[model samples]
Target: MSIAKKLVGQTAAYGLSSIIGRVLNYLLVPVYTKAFLPEAYGVVTYLYSFVALFNVLYTYGMETAFFRFANKPGTDQRELYNKVLSLIGSSSLIFTAILLLASGPIANFIGFPERQEYIVWLAIVLAIDAIATIPFAWLRLQNKAVKFASIKLINIVLTVGANMFFLVFCRQVYNGDYLPELRPWVTSIYNPDFGVGYIFLINLVANALQLPLLWKELSIFRFRLDVDQLKPMLRYAYPLLFMGLAGMVNEVIDRILLEYHLPDNFYPNMSNMAAVGIYGACYKLSIFMSLAIQAFRYAAEPFFFSQANDKNSPQAFAQIMKWFVISCAFIFLFVSAFRDEIASVFIDESYHSGLVVVPILLLANLFLGVYYNLSVWFKLTDRTQFGTWISVGGAVVTIMLNLLLIPVLGYVGSAWATLCCYFAMAAVSYFLGQRYYPIPYPVRSIIGYIVLAVVLLLGVFYVPVQQVWLNYLIGLVVCALFLVIVAARERLLFFNK
Candidate 1:
């Protein structure tokens, strides 16, 4: 099959899983809003943010490293996999052991000592998921997008179904037919008092369910560990570990800073989990950008490596990067135009306070996606240190802005910080990539699209009608005009024939 066809097929399969998976996960927002207080859901938000950061730490760039080394000529593919797998497995084993032993101290440090069990179970969950990361990447390397997406979709379905059972159906069952002898079990399950603990429990269970689906991949493993290959892969992966850590800090440090710096008195005085919940819910509004980046990376990473020796490889990479920027800019403009209504999709009315962050953060993620595309040049050239420096710089900018601005402007400051951080990283990567592995990207056209997006965003924000529906209708028309212009420009550039 042609690469284009393969990509189209792979993306379609993965996109279904991604879109469906996000839909299922989005269901949890409403569930939590109705089932638990905003404060309770805030707990869910905080822990998962921490989970995202630690998952990056525990995986430690090995998934990408596995793909890099495993694709090299004359490399023992199986041995390469085994080396990385063993490394991650051993690290996870040790990490889980420590987490189990030190759950109390860890929980206390995070200010939730009473939820040590949460820490313990989730740490195991993270370890399991981390160890599975290599196998998942292997599936992608092997062109197993269907199976890969199947596993992911199944995981999402199981998670969403379990959460519904726990938070919604469980109450209905207890209230209706199952109340007589099951009262204690029902009461234990239906913690009307607790907030968003059920979401974590459901995630833990869903992630556990993925083990059986991954058994086919796991069974391919040989027990042989290759120390010779391990040394080089470790060398390659170490910089990525720092880069990944810095990247995630850019993505999530806002939530961490909020939890740490926000006054304890703010929530109850404000009549709810005001700041955290708002930030958390508004964050979800950017899932469009995240999902687009993820789906593109799934295909693009291996695709780029596979074609590394082609004479046209640089041209192809440039094209891919341009298209990625164009699509992401389009999504940013599209989503931002309708964010006011999109903000209402989550259950709690109070969360609407953070809606303004959605458009800002969506654009930040646009820059972030572009930065990812640019950073790939460093990875492809094996000059990965550039990625580390860029990400660290971005992280520093993100932290400084959050610290300086959050005290004065609250979550909006964090959103603006994210935008600035990503914009800076994208700029740095573009300039540095030109120095190292220059690809003649369509810089003019890409910048044109960005300018068009910004102009349309201004139209949406500045031109407002009192009726919400009319305002949104006008915004959609404005976005469609931009889209039509984009489509015309793309055709003229690529298909003037």
Candidate 2:
């Protein structure tokens, strides 16, 4: 299949899971936002942030290593897969066991002393997901896009269905079906009146469904472990561990810090917690850009490894990067043009304060997508440390900005901090990639798109289109103008035709 066709297919497969999954996930926003108070939702947000952190830790760097060594000559791909799979599996079991035993202390450390069951159940869920990462990675490497996407879609659908049943449908039918299973600790601390245990119970059920689906991928491993190959792969993957942690830190630290910095009196003001919840909810709307980036990363990483030895690999990389730029620019305009409307679907009107942060976060995601494109250079060259340093630098920028600005600017400050982090990271990585392994990317044409997007966005933001339909019409005109500029400057239309 042609690259374009394959990319289209892959995008569709990914879009099926990501877009559909997110649409179902969006159901939870209204469910939680309406069912639970903002403070309660904030606890959900805080714990999920820790889940994101632990996901990075548990999966570590094996996914990338699998892609790297799986393509190398003389490497027993099956054995290599088994080794990493075994490593992640054993480590997850040990870690989950440890967390289970220490659930009390862990809950206390995170200021959830009364909700140790939350810690324990979620730890099990996370470990299962973490262990599944390798098989999922294998599926991607083998281009089993349909099967991969199906499993993902089912997982989300089951999760959403379960959540709805527990949070909505089953609430009225609450019998003594499982009340005895609730521990004294849970009964004492948790309000049985609220019926919040359903969240964890539903997650537990949905994650367990993956075991049967994963059996096919697990069966592919027939070769035994090779300690010799393990050493070098570990050496290569260790830096990536730090890089992943730093990258996630940049992504998640704001939420963590917000919870940490919030004062005791802040809880009485629903607006304060509401602002955070609103920001978190609307931020998920930016998944359009993130979804594209993730889909590309899934395809591109393995594509890069497979083609790294080709004589024209650099040119291929440059071409793909250019098209990625065009597509991302188009997505940015498409999302921004309708964000005023899109924001409403994510939450009730009470959360509208978050609208101001949406464009900034969307633009930040564009920069992040670009950074992901540029990062391939370092990964291919085995200079993984460069990526780590770049992320750390970006994290520093993000931290300092949030620290100085959040108190003054509120959620908008966090938005700007994110923007700065991605912008700086992309800029730094582009320059470093050129120095280490230059690709003659069309800088002038790319900048033209950037400039046009900024100008058009400014017009959308400033122009007074009070009527919702009229504003959408105005946005379409601005978007068309950006596209025309891109076509004219790059002759994209002529070349495609």
Candidate 3:
């Protein structure tokens, strides 16, 4: 089978599970916004952004190491799996215990002194998630996409279901006159003061429950550590650990910064927390692009490692990168064209103010996706420190730009910061990747498609179509035309007529 075919097949399986599953999960954005005020929603967004950072810290790049080391010829996969699991499990327990012990001080430090249990609950979920990271990576290594997708979807379903039950059903039971008998029972569990805390609480239950379901992946390993293999794996992954933290900074530091940089007085009657809530909701409008890139990474990472020795792998990577760029460009245009529609529905109208940044964030994520493709070079060559340096560069830019801009332009500044950061990261990664790994990516064709997409996007932005249907029609036609042009240029469409 062609590598393209195999890649598409794997990407489809992963996409179905991750992209579709995440979109389904993303539906909760509306549920959350409807349930919690923007200030409360801001708190949820704030804590979860920290969670993303901490998650990277807890996993410490071990998952990628598992993929690389477990695939080595003559290596015992079972033994490697056991060690990886042991390392993550023990570290997660220690991390969780420490956090739980100091939950109060940490909560107070973060200005959430009253919600000390929030820290404790988050620690529990984080520990479970940290430990589960290895087993999930093990499944991906084994090419168990079906199982992977199933387990991921199950977790999503559980989380979403719990969220709806608590936020919707419980609210109905508590507020409605029909449930007179059940009102007190529902009211007992539902605290208006708890607000968005229930969101995290539901996630905790979901994360905890999903671990037991991953017993197949976890059950094989006893609690024994392999010191020798552990050392090399740590050596390999520690650099990636820094890369992960820096990369996360590039990804989510805006959310974190929006809360701190934009104070209550930043805007008349607009709390920084509310701005964050609005920014977080509007950010969800770009999930179409994020979901695609995430699904691609899920399939691509393992696929890249497996094909490391193939003589044609470089050519294949170039081809894959082209398709990825074109696909991401299509998503960018699709979402940008209907940005208002998605934002309007993604959450309440209160979030509509931040919708203007959707296009910027979408384009930023496109660059980030390209960066992900370029990153394969460092990972494949074990030059993982390059990854760390690149991410740190991006992180520095993210911080500097956010610090300089947020007070002036608000979240829009953060959006521009993200776009600039990813563009710089992609450019740097490509320059270094060519020198180090030297994949023959089709530069001209890729540039042509990108230029075309951006032209269309700019045209649409400047020339607003009053009719919604007309706007969508134009977007679809442009998207179709781009695909046709790509196929004709590559001779996949119209052929030797």
* Worst window of 10 by summed lDDT in candidate 1: 265-274
- Model 1: clashing residue pairs? 40-195
Which runs of model 2 end up more than 4 angstroms from their true locations?
Answer: 1-8, 171-196, 220-228, 262-268, 492-497
lDDT of 2 by residue, 112-196 (tens): 7988889888989988998788888888877888888889889989989877766654443343345545444344544446555
After superposition, candidate 1 runs with Cα above 4 Å error: 1-8, 172-189, 263-268, 271-273, 492-497
Whose lDDT is greatest here?
3
lDDT of 1 by residue, 117-187 (tens): 88987898999899889888888888787888899998998888888887777766666656567766787
Q: State in Å the error of residue 271, model 2.
A: 6.5
> Mind giving the per-residue lDDT tens digits that candidate 3 earns over 87-175?
88989999999999999999999889999989999999999999888888888888888988898999999888988888888877777
- Clash count of each predicted structure: 1, 0, 0
Q: What TM-score does structure 1 among the candidates reach?
A: 0.94
- Residue 65's lDDT within candidate 3 is 91
Backbone clash pairs for candidate 2 read: none
User: How do these models rank on lDDT, best leading?
Assistant: 3, 1, 2
Off by over 4 Å in 3: 177-185, 493-497
